[model samples]
Target: MIVGPAQQLAYVAADVARLAAAFVRESVGAAAAASTKSTPTDVVTHTDFESERLIRHELMVRCPGSTIVGEEFDDLAGKNSVGWIVDPIDGTVNFLYDLPVVSVSIAATINGQVVAGAVADILRGEVFDATLGGGARRDGEAISASSVSELGQSLVGTGFSYESTVRARQADRLVHLLPQCRDIRCMGSAALNLCWVGCGRLDAYFEKDLKPYDYAAGALIAAEARAMVDLPERNGEQFTIAAAPAIYDQLRGLVA
Candidate 1:
């Protein structure tokens, strides 16, 4: 039973909001129990695992037979084109430190393409969402990228990869970009940074080695808000640069 794009996005966003509340309940002011995933700094916490389980259970109950991929779940399972990709908690470090910047991100990808997505900023009680051919939104109001036309005047966002090698490459890229942008920020939450770009709160965003669940939903929300999307290398690795259409080319060129 295929669902219309609008209803699918709405349903996903509603579920994201519900799961976000659960995450906050388990995370806020609580002692974090974390372990390394890829390295010492790349961590995952108890809340992350619990949130993903709750979300997956609810999603499967609602859309039986649909494939689901999550940061904390088994990646081997159903292979339906209409798949759900999720990052139960995008900024585990921030959550551990009691920072108010993490989010729960979920996306529906149809045959390798993201068709609908949602990101719930649990700390802020805000949801950013979009669907293919449907304009982006926060809560219920429309949103869009900034109109900044010059890279030198644009505020930018970025994140480091869990892989040390990729993080080194990104650090190198930043050396070339830092002198060109008005300012650069590494907010620790890729999903939230992309949402900020979508809502014109940030001028642009760039990052590499991000998983599908990390950036897919926020990237779609950015594009739906009229941001330009670009990939520097098509080597099966996920590298992205998204910005308001005006300065997008300039930023993309720099990252490329």
Candidate 2:
């Protein structure tokens, strides 16, 4: 079965989301185990690991030849040119606290470029999806970035670094940009923040210390919905700034 990239990606994404939601529901009665990967503030749970494993297993079954790059998984599944990127539990800390803003994100990349993506807002039952040239959608309904042309009228979102040392720099950057905007929100989930931006719920978003999986799917979804995405200025930096085209220039200037 030679499925198209976009179709295949969509299938994998939907499958992952379904499995992720089940994992979250199952964990409600499970024991809370605090585990650290690199630092204390950066937390991982049994759910995160279990969810990633489920997502991986489903992907392999659906697309046998496709490669898999996931946060919870260490090595790539295969070296196929086309692959899937997965973030089983995007907001692990939020999920741990039983917050309703977490999500599962998945993207299909061909030759290192995203071709399709989806982010499932677990608590809201919203699934934002997009294909390379196909328009973005929220649960089958089309979505687009906000039309706000002025920064004073725009509502923006951003995320903080888990590492304390880098978090100060993010806070300092926010200080210079906040006064110029209408308001700012610090959402714990990077993928959901960007998804909301795509659906016209947020005018702009920026963040630091994000991995490829965190923004890969959301970036494509926003871009397909007519939003602009910008990468961090410094090399090896994990910063990202995504916004509606109307205020992209103005907001970019504020952050830059």
Candidate 3:
């Protein structure tokens, strides 16, 4: 493992995520769609900008000159070796619509590797965080993935693409996956879905075409929870997966 101040980075991630989550909680009702990106269905809200701004400023202050790669803003390079990956509002549509599934996620990287991360479920006021080899925790209590070994009995979570054409392809794949698994849940927020997997609320999770910020933080938490994780690189398409060790290969066979 890369030796770094993982615990300290995790703390920083949690602080920024908490700050961003608070902003989202307060701005949800008043926030409206400022514009659409990629497609009409893919929307962005004023709250998103504000949340990311808050996260960026706080993170920079905490870890001065840290590079920030955020959803709504251009990447910032700085003198520090630390880097941050942030998603201000993981569930933009859900937030504007007053749905409680929204989340704020941030990951801290050192030497180009993710060392720590945090995902805050804003409406629930719960924060999940973890560091490399430190295990996962929700609200400071250790959490782990489910022990379920049977694919037919596992609860799976997933998300679709913003592009309808890609979604159509994803749906076709799901037609096969749903029958093989106990059930499927598409929560509209990849980060939240991944965190749920870490806490055992979800047995496994997989999604296609996710951006880095969407899965970065939550993936670390899930992996630290003893979940079998396969995080994709910045290839043209990123198909991410996290499952209990027992059913990992089984679930991946279906989704892959």
Candidate 4:
């Protein structure tokens, strides 16, 4: 496996994300589910596979022998030494519905630990990136999480499951939390939601049933921006939270 500095890996991801995002942005108008996964609503658009292919090829060419786990076709992944976790299109539903809230996310890991990552907003043209022990940035500008101390004044972000039963249960969980916080926004993309938190557009964000590719890049960006984060155990179906420092405890109390 080839090993490089986390900062170097971060740049590789950011560049590839920009490339893939441009390709995906060009295909959004014709978006439709070519298939489904896990559930009928868990869609897989044609562009999803194409985007992942572009990303996988570029990453492999750039980092020879590196492992890759992508959302579109991860069943064929290689070993996880100097690995990458990628979500070629993080908001597939939004893309399929012709909404502009979509992203391309990639995270580089060294021996199972995330060390660098990047998330690019397709239509927004903003890229958020970070490396372990390095601060976060959005389009080359430094970014930070919200400083809001009161949970009632914090603007939170969340998402729902594709499963109707799980969505209903998640909705019920929000009922108790809704009144306790400023209010939640469901942007349909966990990666973008966590980036929004990193840039202070959202004070906190949490969601259940997330896979590694869904939150890997965004979580690193948020954490580098000084947000507190708690992710699910590897391959476990649990919740992930990225919250402002001052409101971390309070926000987790309500959502966790």
Candidate 5:
């Protein structure tokens, strides 16, 4: 019995997330070397490469004909229309500092639409996953966004950019947004932050200058969990906003 793309990709995402989680578990607290990416604040580790390699290999072998695009490596195109977007380590700085707030994210897109995704929080051993029209789950149990209707009562999650100037601007935005919301939390991992929104750990989440590998899986999971999601416009400045339905507009307005 052959499964559909959504089902097949969901399974693949789960497996890949599990594998990456295991790698993180074994590698954490070990003496892993790190290197800078675009800036001094943007760092990568050996675990990131190893985890991406593992995911790319498994995805190619299991799916057979799907392109794999990862944060650490060049794109691997395949024959099928499906494409896998992976973030081997979503919070590398935190991981490097042993902060236990990192995650592995995977998403499958069919002809430009995300069909399925999974995000594994390595330290918590929790996995959040979703398929298009299939809702969302954390560790196999169904989940949804919070019911916080007012922005002043909502606990929002956000992230910063690697560029120094961007970080400065993000701080400025946070200053204006801080008093409007109940409080703001900046978890190092964007993927986990989005999953947190899905599981009701956060009432809302928004960030700017995110890459496809950063929010691909997480945004899908949040939307499936009944959160309102606004992805960044294509070929323009990248920004994302996901929040509970009741507070989406208020949050977007304040942040804007």
Candidate 6:
């Protein structure tokens, strides 16, 4: 009855993603009853907590002995080294507004290193997933990062923080970056944005003030698809950058 992390990636991740997608689909619109988190712009809803509860329950039943870290609740202790990072709704604002850009993300880590992960684009019904050494995929088909070699030709993706002050600084940085790349997009969901880079929909992506659950799944998927990924860290604040090898350095330099 024991399920390895790889099996969890290959099977459980997708299963949970579908479950999450169903929950999102069923709860869209005013019924979500959204409420503000840090700012009026930062939203959450009953669906977010419910989705995480469902996912955590499933993970506990299928992959027992694994820790569960979720955005909506405190960490759940486990007896083994495996850990499940969950972002039940990665773009809650988008979900609140009935935008089709939200997603559900889950990742499995062992000894603090992510080994498997999945991101479910709820509105699109696409699932992006990967395991360590196993290539990334979207809806079961293999995917890869773009090969665009120059920043001027690359379409980059990014997100702003909910804090207005932080956003002011981020906008200031973007002022320098906007004119350098082919273009930039703010997709709202960091997880999906990273998956977009993995699938070649975007050549690069960067953002500040993210949580571990925000990029855990998508980072693994991007890296597995041959994209270079740097998760946010504590140099006074957290930030993340993921890009195709060809344009990573240029993009990083501009953002830095």
Report, for all candidates in order, the number of backbone clashes: 0, 0, 0, 0, 0, 1
Candidate-wise lDDT, in order: 0.82, 0.82, 0.90, 0.91, 0.90, 0.88
Candidate 3 lDDT by residue in tens digits, 1-256: 4645999999889988998898888886777899999899899998899899999889877889889999999999978789999999999999888888999999999977999999999999999999989999999999999999899999999888888888999898899999999999988889988888888999999999888899999999999999988877843347899998899999988887
Clashing pairs in 3: none
lDDT of 4 by residue, 95-123 (tens): 99988899999999999899999999999
Q: Which portions of model 6 show Cα errors greater than 4 Å?
A: 1-4, 234-237
Using lDDT as the measure, which candidate wins?
A: 4
In candidate 6, which residue pairs get closer than 3 Å at backbone N, Cα or C atoms, i.e. clash?
232-239
Residue ranges of candidate 3 with Cα displaced over 4 Å? 1-4, 234-237
Superposed by TM-score, candidate 6 places the C-alpha of residue 45 at a distance from the truth, in angstroms, of: 0.7
lDDT of 5 by residue, 1-256 (tens): 8777797799889988998899878988873557888987688899999999999989988889888889999998889789999999999888888898999999999997899999999999989999999999998899999998899999999998889898898898898999999999998899999989998999999898999999999999999999998888642547788899999998888774
lDDT of 4 at 181: 88
Model 5, 198: alpha-carbon shift in Å? 0.8
Task: Using lDDT as the measure, name the better of candidate 5 and candidate 6.
Answer: 5
Candidate 4's TM-score reads 0.95
The window of 10 residues in a row where model 1 has the poorest summed lDDT is 230-239
Tens digit of per-residue lDDT, candidate 2, span 1-256: 7767686677668667866766676675453655887677888888888888888888777777778889876856575778888898888887777777788998888877789988888778778888899878898889999989888889999988778888888788888888889999987888888888898889999887788889888988888889988764343456688898989988877765
Clashes of 5: 0
lDDT of 5 at 112: 73
Worst 10 residues of 4 by lDDT: 73-82
Residue lDDT tens for model 6, 1-256: 8866575655788789778888878887754555777788777899998899999988888888889999989999989988889999999888888888999999988887889899999988899999889789998899999989899999999999999998999998899988998999998999999999999999999999889999999999999999998876534448799999988888878785
Model 2 worst lDDT run, 10 consecutive residues: 230-239
User: Candidate 3 clash total?
Assistant: 0
Which residue pairs show backbone clashes in model 5? none
TM-score of each: 0.91, 0.92, 0.96, 0.95, 0.96, 0.94
Better of 2 and 3 by TM-score: 3
